[model samples]
Target: MKRLLLFILLSVFCLSLPLSAKAEGLRFGVPPWPGVTVKSEVVCQILEAMGYKTSQLEIGPPIIYKGLTTDDVDAFLAGWIPQQNEMFLPLKEKKAIDVVAINVDEAGTSLCVPTYVWEAGVRSIADLAAHAEKFDSTIYSIEIGSGMQVSTEDMIANNVAGLGGWNQISSTTPVMLSAVQERIRGKKWVVFHGWQPHWMNFQLDMKYLEGVPGTEKLVSNSVVYTVVSNDFAKRYPQPYAFLKKFYVSGAVQSEWINDFGFKKIAPEKVASDWIVANLDTVGEWLEGVTAADGSAGIDAVRSRFAN
Candidate 1:
């Protein structure tokens, strides 16, 4: 009778623990960007090493913002600010989300044209005016609501790029890339939004046009950050701290983006490979960061990964 009572007590105690205590699954949100997706996977793998199960909730820009506000999502690794300033400000004002840390600052979105366009002297925003006919009087952009579109519209509205009359066409990134590829194949003139640390840069020999005198030219240092829900830190302070302390260098992220973008390697494989080789770097992220259950950080990660 005593043995049975002890067994029953042990079972009851185990049942009382939170499911997260039994299975540390962290839900991370990812947008369609390759770098963001890849980095999130890398972080998730690291968390998994600490006995946490990580799941990605893929969402568009608007949905991601909504998820954070509703606490339907835990975190997003790709929060590009300043560019995303308009979107984040309202949420911030409402105290719906928290900016965790600046992850990679070596990236930017800018207007770029083919090398041929540069060769033909279309070197600046002002240069586009002369070749408006060649560009079909249209500015190719990614998604309709993306920051690039917003910025492009602003430029057109303000008549900063001599593109005041140009039409902005919205489409998915892949579609825009395909259009670019078509133009590249025929060596035709095209002007579109571009960014660095992306596969497109590696895949194509392109040039970012210098901004017109009064307009802001997109350049590097447009830092991408990590964002979490306002309730995240409060509910899971330990994991939140780990995320806050986490930092992935520019070179590291660029390399991963290059590999995934150009080599066409699977994201999971890239993530797994990166995690295994960069244990030391990842160790730094775990510094002073404990597991969700309050175990030794390094030990928990090591045991989890090594197993």
Candidate 2:
């Protein structure tokens, strides 16, 4: 009887212990964009608190989408629409990728000019030809193979809004922004692909162009969603649930961008500080989510964030 009692006690003790302190590791696809970098970091910290290991892969959107469909990448937080439709829509239609949720809705991405230039009569993409000399018939872009570059290419090919003969100048986001900054400082005419929820919108006095040939729907309001592999929900329902509930306003993300990029704060510190101060908001994301040990996710995050 004593031996049986000892055996039962041992089983009870084993059951009482939490499951692996670190569950399956999650990989997040993070582009070089500051907003997504900070946002992904925040999500990583939250998931880690829930006993899940997390990692961020810094790559461009096209490669990330390919990774998702092939099961190489688990989650991607920077799925920008309209601009990314070429890469995102087809897979979405085939049911090859799962869009978990729209994390930001108030973002805008398009050809933009300095506000002074806007006031100087270059209010739309069509107006570029009239003053092509001032702009040097050049449209600047971020990164060579970006979705923005694709749109710029289409516009050039179709001569959309008379963009024919207009050439593209491509570089990374910071370099593109630096060119804009230099041009704007001298009051020179410049046009480039621009987006909000970025430090550029905050630091530069620029305006997104109006009346592009296509993009009639939400042209000025780009939507960003959290996307994952097709079977993410079924494979990791707990973390999936938390991610499904993760949403942040464009204003909030812009603030985070400014904090991390402009203010020079580290992304991890920004995410950690935000979670520590906004537990109530974090609680909402963890509403029906749980840790690997089958405990409330909020409880684990709370303990992790608690000083």
Candidate 3:
């Protein structure tokens, strides 16, 4: 009787050990922007190589913040600060979500006009008010719940730059680009929101409008961050360290987005190819890091991607 009891207890302990040691999977929140989607996919791939199972959930900017607060999301790699100031500030004060690190830097987000429109004298955000009729009294923007949309709403609410009655026509990035293309095709005057690290900059001959005297600098900004749960650093030191060291520039993201933007390739494939081609850079990301299962980081990644 005693021997049988000991054997059963040992078997249960062994089985429980494996269950308790299993790494928690990740549920990542991704916004609907080409640059962000591509970047998030790359990060997910890297994390997967490290042995963490990642799920990408496409939620709006607002929902991402809420998700973080509710513990419904594990991370978001597309947190654009200052632009996303309203969403993060209050939650941050409550100790809900934490800013991990800036993943992509030297980014630009603001209103712009075709170079031809600038030639016709709409070279500034303030210039739009006077040419409201030409622009249809509308400022084109991305999805309704985006940070850029919030910024646009603030501008209208505050009547910034004499844009009191201006209507914001909300659309997706592709639709906004189509609007720009239409204006360009007809040589019409149009003012709309624009940003850098986008294929649009390459596709369209457009220029950013100068914000009002003190605001121009703010609109032409950079650096979108990787934000994780506040406890993520303490609970997952290796992943945190790897994310902190993970850095990519606007040029890198723009090129990748452009590659898929013009031609149709999987975002994951682009990221994998980038990883394989830039093994030296990725090696640095994996330095001092280990797989989710505690295996060697670089070796695990190489083998996983190799297959």
Candidate 4:
């Protein structure tokens, strides 16, 4: 009878422990871009409210994907398709990672010039070379080793848009934008890498150039995806399921990015404010999902962020 009583006590003690005690905390990779930063925070905040411990690592794209493959990072929310296709395809082929969901769509990157430049007879990629003197034969881009930078290089090497001797300036996003702002103020001609779901679209008076003939591939629209290491779903099914339901439209994502990128709000504050304002939408992401302790996920989030 003593043995039976001790077994019962042990079982009760085991059941009393929180589920998170037995589960590994999630590690999310956040790229430098504002949109992805905001998205990562939104996911992390919701998971935290669901009783899961989480951490955000500020890693760039190449490292993020490699980390996902090696299980160093559990997930990344900024896998921009087509633009990132070259980076994601091999790992996907090896079954090293899984794209959980398309978080944002109708997104894209391309060479863009200020509206004044556009209005001044520079409406297409083909027009850039004609005004090369005004643009100083330069195209500004963010970071070395980015897909956009590579594409810009290809354009220069291949002499696309007659840019045979052109130069692509490499810099961070903030520096590139600051240059754009300066150019806009001076009403000077400037061409730079541009994409949606970014504050630049709203803040700058610019237009994406029409693709040059035979170079259409460089200006294609892209879809941003949430990606996870292959083992993530099996290891953390609740958070995985919640992540799969996550979806943010291009327009809405741009708004979140603008709040963080332009308004200079903290990413967590931007996420929380969006969550508080869009409870109905947040509920959709939590549908059929549960907290780490098997409680209703939506209820936990609502209670935690009720203010």
Candidate 5:
């Protein structure tokens, strides 16, 4: 009968809706950063323990923001303030995404120099101009069109802190770090972009600059937040609840970076090992959270990782 046919078609249509809309699983936008790599992995493992399936879209920040707006990605764990505000703020104003939580504490990104350079009176942005010859009037940064690159270019183009006419070198993270490392080996004066909760902070003996005229945006973003799509909560409240509870300290993130970035350990293994080592924090994150199967979130996680 026609009525039967209509019912079946409607059922199929409902079933074909996005699994995320039904809160079946979650998609995470993962940018190519070491701290986020392990951080996302740890969250994925915790969610898996709660019986939820998870996927990661390995992409850049711009694309990730686009995906979030389009409902293609449900969550992003690496929304750095000020640096990402160019792309994030507009969406936030439009209510396209929600800045959920500040996952990492004591976090920041800014230009820094070798300890020797800092010891030689190059402690602040103003001092860099005095020793322009030592640094060759060059500022090193990472990635073309990246947030840090954009900010550095602004500093030079607008002549902030006497940076006008200073050459800005931009490249991939690894390449830029290699050049910085080479300069450090020779103890040559070099200034490069750096951030906390990253291996570079530990590996390199350097100092984060302060007292820059136009560095309020750069130096003030000392914490990173979790960003989720607008519908992420209403559509997937279960996962959203767990995500809201997620938080990590700067020291913990740096340890994760060391294992995943410097030691080259697989992020999955690193996440699992950290979970096993820090059940107390895991329990804290699971407070008032529920698993996919409707069980207590903390209990589910503990049971899964009991081994």
Candidate 6:
């Protein structure tokens, strides 16, 4: 009788273990940028629909690549090219991570001014120095360690576009955007780091400044990729295949950001609504993939959207 009780106790202990312990799921690392946040949400929601458990870690770029290298995170969807080339190149050389797919193409980053400011004859980086006093000899940019900040520093050091004495105001994204909005309202001259796949492109009447001879690379077009750990694909073939097939246009991503960032909607709801409206896109992403329960991935995702 005691032996029978011991067997039943052991069975209960095994049953009490968490589902995650039994089935390892994907862990996605997301930066603070809205576009990346929404992209991560869309992928996580789709994975959940396909019966795979997923989680997102809010990490910054400097540490995210390291996280991927150390296998602390499984994947990231905001690997912006050329702009992030410095951080990604070494990892690529070492085969530490894989560029699984180009999640967003035709994306670019540059200094942008309000349409009125552009109309005021400050349409290029070279034009900035001429009106230095008007712009307070300062350019607004996000956090100190960002690539934009680094490029701005180089521009100052090299006197590129005659901006040798110009200063860069470093702050968070929301603070920078708020400052831009205030300056726009006052018809003031302001230049700040701007990128596609963000609501600011739609919310503000802005134009990217033309790159000058020495500063052109700072404003070049960039492709955002989905990057995964080296062993992620081999360990989880279905999720890897689904991610490989995933793609979203810059316009579509901007809409998602506008909804989540400006309209105050939840990320999961935005992702779900997008999936419902664009089932064909989701179907394509899930082609040749199956759910955790071995059911058709497209069908599972479609059924979730239907309900």
lDDT of 4 at 265: 97
**Tens-digit lDDT track of model 2 for 155-256:** 787777777778877655655676678888998999988888888878988888886646443245788999999888988899999988999998889989
**Model 5, range 1-307, lDDT digits (tens) per residue?**
5633443344333323343443336888876678888999999999899988988776667777887988788899988887877888899999888888889877888889999889988888888888889999988776555577778888888888898999877655655777789899998999988988889988999998885768766656566899998888897787788788889889999999988888889999999999988888898888888887889988988897878
Question: What range of 10 consecutive residues in model 1 has the weakest lDDT sum?
Answer: 14-23
Q: Give the distance in Å from residue 89's predicted Cα in candidate 5 to where it truly belongs.
A: 1.5
Better of 2 and 6 by lDDT: 6
Candidate 3 has its poorest 10 consecutive residues by lDDT at: 14-23
Candidate 6 lDDT by residue in tens digits, 114-173: 998899898888899999999989888765545666677788899998999888776556
Q: What is the C-alpha lDDT of each candidate?
A: 0.74, 0.81, 0.76, 0.82, 0.81, 0.82
lDDT of 5: 0.81
Candidate 1: C-alpha RMSD after superposition: 13.3
Supply the TM-score for candidate 1.
Answer: 0.85
lDDT of 3 at 152: 85
Clash statistics: count for each candidate:
1, 0, 0, 0, 0, 0
TM-score of candidate 6 on Cα atoms, chains taken together: 0.88
Q: Among all windows of ten consecutive residues in candidate 2, which has the lowest summed lDDT?
A: 14-23
lDDT for residue 45 in candidate 2, whole number 0-100: 93
Question: Which regions of candidate 3 fall more than 4 Å away from where they truly are?
Answer: 1-24, 213-218
Off by over 4 Å in 2: 1-24, 215-218
Compute each candidate's TM-score over C-alphas.
Answer: 0.85, 0.88, 0.87, 0.89, 0.87, 0.88
lDDT of 1 by residue, 157-252 (tens): 887757788887655565567777888899888988888668787788899887666456343348788889888888877678788877776777
**Mind sharing the TM-score for model 2?**
0.88
Candidate order, TM-score descending: 4, 6, 2, 3, 5, 1
